[model samples]
Target chain A: MTDVPESSRTLPKNSGIQEIRLGFTLQHWCLWQSKETPFGEFWPGGEVLPYNGGRADVSFFPMMQSRRLSPLARAVSAVAWHSRQQCGDIPSVFLSSHGESQYYFEILQGMAGGEGVSPSRFSLCVHNAIAGLSSIHNASYQPYLSLAGGTEGMFAAFLEAGGILLETSKVLVVWYEQALPDAYQAYLATSETTFALSMILTRGGGPGHQLRLARRPGKGGSNAEDCTTSLVQTILEGRRSAVCHLEQSIWQWSLDDA
Target chain B: MKNLEAELKQLIIDTLELEGVNPKDIASDAPLFSGGLGLDSIDALELGVALKKKYHIHIDTNSAELANYFASIKTLAGFVVSQQNKSTL
Candidate 1:
């Protein structure tokens, strides 16, 4: 866990602190073994929608199945869906590890083959596509920020969003990641999984929910996908839902039946 | 002429994801925003961006002209056609 700067440690209250609402979407495979199906049992409740060859509309499944979205896109869609469900218009910050991996792989392959990379893929390869898409989706001009760190990606994103909430009244933080495609999966050494979590932070205190800034021990570590899932489960445990931001990860969960 | 209106209506329907709307249902001259179609400000912005990106014509966003541009599918398609013609000329 990196040290949070003293300047960003405290939140300003004059800016109208709002209650944070948290939501999450995860791969069905991850939740199959859990006692409760996180997304299916909660918001947008119903059957577990498949990614490709299924009748139901799996929220973020298309990106994974079609391979159309980069890792960043997966993250962005998660946040966008959550924001649309929550306040309808809130600023967002997205964090990812291997953003646009397939695009980057293709660009590298093109370079190796003496062909230039496609401009479209190049433009979308940046870590901020999620932020850009969120702005477009909400028709909002609010400022957005993006962060990328190796294993510490989620931590960095959480810290930045917490800082923003401290400065403003509210902030939305999103952490998303997808396993790399087969070809580069080995190089990246990540599990073939997809996970997304969103947290809304407000200055005003809320009932049955509190966010504590504390450090327990060595850098909290786990599977990125599982980390996102655990975060959601932890928040959802006590109340219908709450956003939890630990030094390691940020997650939202529902405590009550949805 | 009716077919053209229908085609334009279908385009709007698909583009805007106006659920439960069929091409035959849209009245040609009905207003898109705050009218029969129920499009909102974000839909307007999205439609505007989609038009420019897909059809290669810019739609001005000024308040006075927005009403004229988004009056109906016919109005929007006509505007697009005219912009195409202008670009060619």
Candidate 2:
């Protein structure tokens, strides 16, 4: 964790072009999905190991002690815990949309039913719990930034990552969502899925092709963003880059040949 | 008495989410908290709710006599037996 000089650490917000350019190299990554039962089951015929219905391996964090993590925490932490091992004690940014829905539903249901709320569920209600556990498990004192708003947490997560990657050598980014319990099916988003993606990204500008981000469609691009799951599929296939349609603007991702 | 202690052990493991721990590992007369199982305040609250629901007994966590009932698996089983006996009588 050597310090990057303050002046050159983050990407400039306004670069005068239709797109503000920021570069980052992808080093190592891990993905997790836990929609199906029988934890750690594999999904076949895909670059990512755990597919939509397969379970995540919770044994990654043996020191986590309690097996009491909710299915979402297990899935989210499995990938996050692994990335910390892969990336070392780097700073991180955690993003999740509606991750609170799982335990929130449980707590509210219990409270409404007049049963004492499960204290574990209550402790886990905070979105930062995901980031908190990641830091604790990694034994890193570095603050893991937490972002938990809007349907497009993945895109927002990267935007924040770009800011830090500009200043640091590497940043671990974890983006995830859990399958909303059956009771909340009506609120599901098209991009949201019960999956997580972990990445250790290095500061951009090196020899091999790296990922460069800008406002999609140039100045007047259509506000169409790729869903998080599909973006991963695109990246998995070794595509040049992906686009994420966001509010009012689209995020265009492309490979920068350096 | 042994059966009741074993039952209590499984209940604690299941309700508290103690991964990789076995019922046989828990000492029946050992403390359930504070240097024994090392469970925390939240675990106590959760266990209290579970005890009330399972035994159909009223467990006031704030009561002065509560510690005696939960000091160990042996004490918990004894409390349950006494409560059940009183109800049946």
> Candidate 1 chain A vs. true chain A: TM-score?
0.60
Which stretches in model 2 have alpha-carbon errors above 4 Å? A1-19, A35-53, A63-66, A190-193, A207-209, A216-226, A256-258, B1-3, B64-68, B80-89
- The parts of candidate 1 lying over 4 Å away from their true place are A1-75, A187-189, A216-226, A229-258, B1-89
| Candidate 1 C-alpha error for residue B24, in Å | 20
How much of the real interface does each model capture, measured as fnat? 0.00, 0.58
Going through the candidates in the order shown, the clash numbers are 6, 6
TM-score for each predicted model, relative to the true structure: 0.49, 0.79
lDDT of 1 by residue, B1-89 (tens): 46656766776666665545678788877888776766666566656755776667766666586678688877877777788888999
| Candidate lDDT values, in order | 0.53, 0.69
By summed lDDT, which 10 consecutive residues of candidate 2 chain A come out lowest?
Answer: A37-46
Which tens-of-lDDT digit does each residue in B11-81 have in candidate 2?
99989988778998899989988889888777888888787778887666577988888889999999888
| Per-residue lDDT of model 2, residues A60-167, tens digit only | 566324366776676677777777766678889988767668788888888898877777778788889877876776679876898874544366777888888667
Residue A161, candidate 1: C-alpha displacement in angstroms: 1.9
